[model samples]
Target: MRNVRPWRLVAAWVIVILMATTVPFPSGLIETGPFPFDKVVHFGLYAVLGWTVHRAVRAGGGRRPLSILAAWAVGIAFGALDELHQHLVPGRDPSVADWAADAAGYTAAFLASSVLARKSSRKEQR
Candidate 1:
């Protein structure tokens, strides 16, 4: 059996994020108090995006350094585009804070992925 293409997985996840952003939410649905839960959701969503992008890059035969850089670029670029796309959605105004959260989430995921990959590679070498 052939392995599923990693880039296809990335595209599917991207579509999911886009579809989710296209929906209009009820008033106060996204924000739930002094601490906006919306940012958490954004962070979590983009975290997965980051992980997928990283895996896709590595699967595509990119070197470790290149995959890390590419994943960060793709994750941040998509986050920015998604923020702009929010302009068309009702009840959603794009905020820089959200983008920052997106970046932070992806950065965290990338670092974690790199560490895990290193460990796995070491195990394989043993």
Candidate 2:
């Protein structure tokens, strides 16, 4: 509430992107799981993006909800764009459904963070 540390926020942003882009599953780590971790990849990425936005807003000494929400929306857009970018790669092709999943994850992350922030605010007021 008092200080907005720029370095810390940017560091978080980098870490989020790095973790999201790196697939540790070796392309065949799971053979027979009912639910593939591929979907989880989308969820975790967007959630981190949402959390990054929230953190950046807090870091910049901004308190308005819209700022964070805007950041989250941008994050979702970036996720979609990134997928499209992947299509240009030799081995990657974009999937609309995956983008939808990314959007869902982004929204879910934003909603969860907003609720948690609101709850924390209430607690601080008490």
Candidate 3:
């Protein structure tokens, strides 16, 4: 893997957070019935956030476990804050299910990254 600047990762994360908080959902866009598409959006957005956090941590010299923990923590906390912010929006309200989806996404991304890292390390060893 090429060397990645930690600050770049941080900047990306900040941009993602800003976008997530500032954007208002269009009416009927997230209201797909029978399948909870909002949850999927929450999951995808926070998964990217978690991946960026993990990359930033790793680039800054954090160990794998620490990076995973930090990614999950930051992702979930940010999700909670996003939900709270949504409550203030005219057409939006806070939902616990969204937060759960965010956490699940973060966990999935973190584990996937961990597995990939382990594989890479093993390949380097061999």
TM-score winner = 1
Better of 1 and 3 by lDDT: 1
Between prediction 2 and prediction 3, the one with superior TM-score is 3
> Model 1 off-target regions past 4 Å?
1-4
Q: List the residue pairs that clash in candidate 2.
A: none
Q: Write one digit per residue (lDDT tens) for candidate 3, span 22-124.
A: 6766655676788788788778877776676666666666775765676668667877887888877766777788788888887788667766767887999
RMSD of 2: 3.8
Which ranking of candidates, highest TM-score first? Answer: 1, 3, 2
Query: Native-vs-model 3 lDDT?
Result: 0.73
lDDT of each: 0.81, 0.66, 0.73
Question: Per-residue error at 54 for model 1, in Å?
Answer: 0.8
Model 3 spans with C-alpha error above 4 angstroms: 1-7, 26-29
Model 3 residue 104 CA deviation in Å: 1.2
Best by lDDT: 1
Instruction: Assess the local accuracy of residue 80 in candidate 1 as a C-alpha lDDT between 0 and 100.
Output: 91
